[model samples]
Target: MKKLVSLLWAVTLLAALALSACSSNQATEALTGGDENLSLDKEFGGFGGGDESPGFGDPELMNDSPEDAQVSDVIADEPAVIDAMSSDSPVKAFFLRITWGLLEGDSSATEVIDWSGSAEVSRGTLLVLRTIRFEGNDFVHLPRDSRQKVEFTSQTKRHFDGLLLAIIDNDTTASDTDATDGTFTFVAGSFSKVLNFSELDSLDLLEPVGDMGNEVSIVTRAKDIVPFAGGFFAGRWVKTRRDGGEFKGRWINSLGTNTGFLRGIWGINRFGNKVFKGKYISANGEFRGLLAGQWTFTRGDRAGVFEGRWVNRQHKTVGRLKGHFRTGRAGDRRGHFEGRYRVTHRENAEGSDS
Candidate 1:
């Protein structure tokens, strides 16, 4: 519910903060009002349990060469997407709240791509399925092993990233270490989308890995993903202004801030790292602001007590959000996430560029 997003691109940066992020306009629908369903307790599902992500245990799955990126026999998204926790749990729970229908709407009726997210692992544990000439339901539903066929590929000298190549494209049993443009084919899922980095970048949602052609390992913990509600996330926040004061504001995701300083909409989309970026209407809400932060569990492994921070537009530290939300897997469940913020009133904000 709280997040980012991207496009041809607009990024916010501040010298005092180690974050560069953009806002998304896609999440405006949910921000109109608050949904009471978020009051339920959130569940935290553990990884050392029942769900399985099939990897090569047999000798054939191993790489013949040492340097090649290790591949797995995954029900790849295109081939396999990033490792998905239980679709019903981590994957499904998040998607259930998202407004999926308008994810990639085109102005003209002629459609080129279709995107869908699933709570079931078999369909794809992630969002945004980018493909062309695809007729199957999802990559996971395609041939399990080496039965998937590559339907078409762009003639560019493009190589799939490890996530796209390994998880969504290539199978563990077959490793085309020296995979070429046309020769390499795996019977897992079709990867018809152009492999060009720039083209992939055009897909606003895939910006997380737009900079590189390798696997971008984004390790998201329960703490980070669990607390988010996909809509209005309001909490008591502190500002380091006027000798420090506290205020309550809603954190709008995939869009801009909703209030002034101490509150504003900060757009967050899935990024390359666990870091979350946002823009705030700060400096007393009169000015446009930017904040970059990350989420983590303050206590043990679970999100019993979570923590995060945001650097204000004045290049001052203003947010230290500490709160809790119940973690659950099913989509219908709701969890309450409330916390207090302590402000650090910076008398003289530093850094002209933020």
Candidate 2:
């Protein structure tokens, strides 16, 4: 009887040990994705996990490690997170109509032309305006009886002394026809003009053109200049890993006054390229705009160069940015960057009037 009892106890002890071993194996598999060679210790070490793990601060982690290269390859195969342009909607814009003869080189004259015909102007007709000398174009949608304003860049105002505005009817089945075209000098104080379509040879035909009217009204205005410094910018950046980082810097004008501050983020995309984006605000925190660009670095290198453009909220390229950065220690998150920026002027920057 004593021998039988001992045998029963031995069986129970063996069964409990087997059950515990199975549970332990399952938990290990769950943590290591069932890979016999991989472990939580190895993976976490690369990210500063354990005392035995070599952190990113180690130059070997960036250069000689096959594991790091494999990780980069995996990331490069992923899809992009950010596109070149953030928005695609049409910007708010205004329209202006000025008569033919009244635009004749007079800066201060305010003569309105009278027409007898009450022709109706259709919506969706394209109005094309350009400077004869400068290489910029403005396309506006025509709305009946509405006075709209035109925007000119400081560069356009300084370079092009004259303006030519034209109306075109775009036809899908036929060639586009010109309804009216006029040339006039742009004066600063005068924003309103009466454009007479009757003066155009296209409007003089006996046959009524596609939505061609006897007259239309147009106006032109200059954008208010906001005083800000433009020149070189210098700043520092830091990252927890190759995939995410932040940077901050100061920009100055030609006079070397600390005009504004810039702060933004940097990251490595799926393609393995380093991309960064940020915004600049005036010292008073009043004026603000966006900037974006990429970093060019060689494999295994601790330093690299970068270049990109700065744009307004409208996504118009207003300035340029270029700089370089250097990493500190094997786990250091800090780096430095410096670059220059220049703001460009435009008469009609791409954006909505709203």
Candidate 3:
């Protein structure tokens, strides 16, 4: 009976070992596709077609790491993006123009005073007034064909105060009734609007034209709505330097969009005199002219001013330029210059100073 019990125990042991060996071979075959040459690491590396292999104790499917979670949280905390071209952006410059219009009055003595000009008001602020008519009349009559243009810049913390008008009339008698039918165009930064005199009342208010949201306010009175007879312009000297420096700026015309660009170089000659020379290129770069000017130092060469003339290829003067500049330090190569350029002779082209 003892020998039979030992035999049974031995057989059971052998069966258990055989079953374990079979299970191990099946697992290896599943991992390596029955390729004995393939190592466990190489089989695992190709698992799921991924370059990496899971560690012995790692989870089959991984979650995002702590660093990835932190990055996602940071992204969620960011503020919404703002549009750069939105109306809320600050305006840098502006141009306004009044086309042909007429002012009618009850009596023959009704007069129309027409004028257009540009001015530099307050540092860095350019005010251009094209043909704006202030008439001593009762009503404005605008024809269907007339048009106008207006533009201006906006400040972050400041508002446009008002326009200053100086009406000079030498004759007492009323001038021949100026044409009354016209329109006006206004531009403030990216905001632009064209309004006819007929669409406006004696006192019209124009605002919120470009989704500006109360940022701009324009009031039109009866007398201020006459046709533009002449040309007026104003622009800032964007960049100017004295004593061997570059001179560059934009010249806005009465029509508002007929912009011209001036680029030149200035330096002191062997005689110690400051001189500048450059060219005036139209906005489209089709028209061009020559510019030459002299710089006169007022503050002992530290701060000074300049004046010059722009001429056609024939050497005939078409406009005048005058501006002031001040260097931050003694012997500094660059200076802050601001001035005005007036067109004396109108050119034939569209961008030739109106």
Candidate 4:
């Protein structure tokens, strides 16, 4: 009985071994491209053709996929900064011009002004000149067929210059021949700003037109809108009475270069409404500063007036000062300081905005 049992066990063990061998062979066939299991090799072309073995791995596939290829989105930062700098501030429009002279030789007195620049006020440079107000010629004399009779209208006076007038109101259209007899018509109601002229373009007519010379143009430029004193004052302030001689070196603050060589930078300050300030720096660093102290401002009228004292290093009040200030209007230049200031050895008041 024992022998028979042993024989049965031996047969069962051999059968089991055979079955395991078959399973192993099937698995090897699939891995070597024999069995029907889809993989990247079959779908995308590999060296194997069913049950045949290729190399351990496809070198071509491995090389095609780079480890460092980038494929996403990106961002930027300079245009925003540039946009901030180009905007219009209070200081950019702080210049002024006045018209104190009128011409006696032409038709009723009118002034022409013009201004041109970027829609962004800060990008524009100012140019001003004085000229006769443009009125249509004496229309009664010229006939309809005459080219000299082309009608053009007069424009309101621009204080800085007629260029400002022409640009602002398109007044350049008006023209008249010196000796030609005729009348011209113009677009109505263009007159606006005051006018000023330092010299006349032609002497053929009787008088010089525009602001009598007092109506001269003045300009002030800056990157942004700072205070009047801040924009104009610069350098160091030394006492004239001290060993340093008061106005010893250049005094720079905000307004501009405060050297003795500077003429004057005159304009109104919207400082707490509208105020007037002027700087007259001399060789020794002495200057007279004034502010328009009045508050009465009408739409077409002037505003603010200032008066003050300035001393040199010697402790003596050196120069007399005067100027006017106008408010509200875009073309007002009344607060211009014209008088001179003398700088001696003494230091004057500190002109810093602080």
Tens-digit lDDT track of model 4 for 1-354: 999999999999999999977854543243233523321122111212111111113333223211211111111113532232232322122222122222111223364433211111111222221222223321111122322112222233422211111111112233433332211111122222222221111001111123422132222222333232212211111111111010011222222223332221122222322222223333333333321122222223422223344333333554333222332222211122222122222234433322
Residue 73, candidate 2: C-alpha displacement in angstroms: 55
TM-score, structure 3 vs. true = 0.34
- Winner by lDDT: 2
RMSD, one per candidate, in order: 22.6, 25.7, 32.8, 36.4
Whole-model Cα lDDT of every candidate shown, in order: 0.25, 0.37, 0.36, 0.25
Leading candidate by TM-score: 3
The deviation in Å at residue 341 for candidate 3 is: 2.7
Report the candidate with higher TM-score, 2 versus 3: 3
Q: In angstroms, how far off is 307's CA in candidate 3?
A: 1.3
Give the alpha carbon lDDT tens digit for every residue of 1-354 in model 2.
999999999999999989977854553344233544432222111111111212213342223111100111121122321110012212111222222221112233343222211212232222323222223442122222331223332122211122223222222233346543332222222232233423332111111112211111122211113223234454455543443455566654422345566666565543555677666665545434566777765423444567787666556676666655543332254444445554554422222111
Scored against the true structure, residue 68 in model 2 reaches a CA lDDT of: 7
lDDT over C-alpha atoms for residue 257 of model 3: 31
Q: Write the per-residue lDDT of candidate 1 for residues 1-354, one digit (tens) a residue.
A: 124534212343342233322211112222211322211111110011111111112122112111222223333333224334222234211111111111111123232222332212212122322221123333323323333232222211111211122112223443457343222212212221223211221111211122222111111112113222121233322211211111223433211122222222111223422232333342222333334444433323212333455444344564444433222122212112233332333333222211
> C-alpha displacement of 234 in model 2, angstroms?
0.8
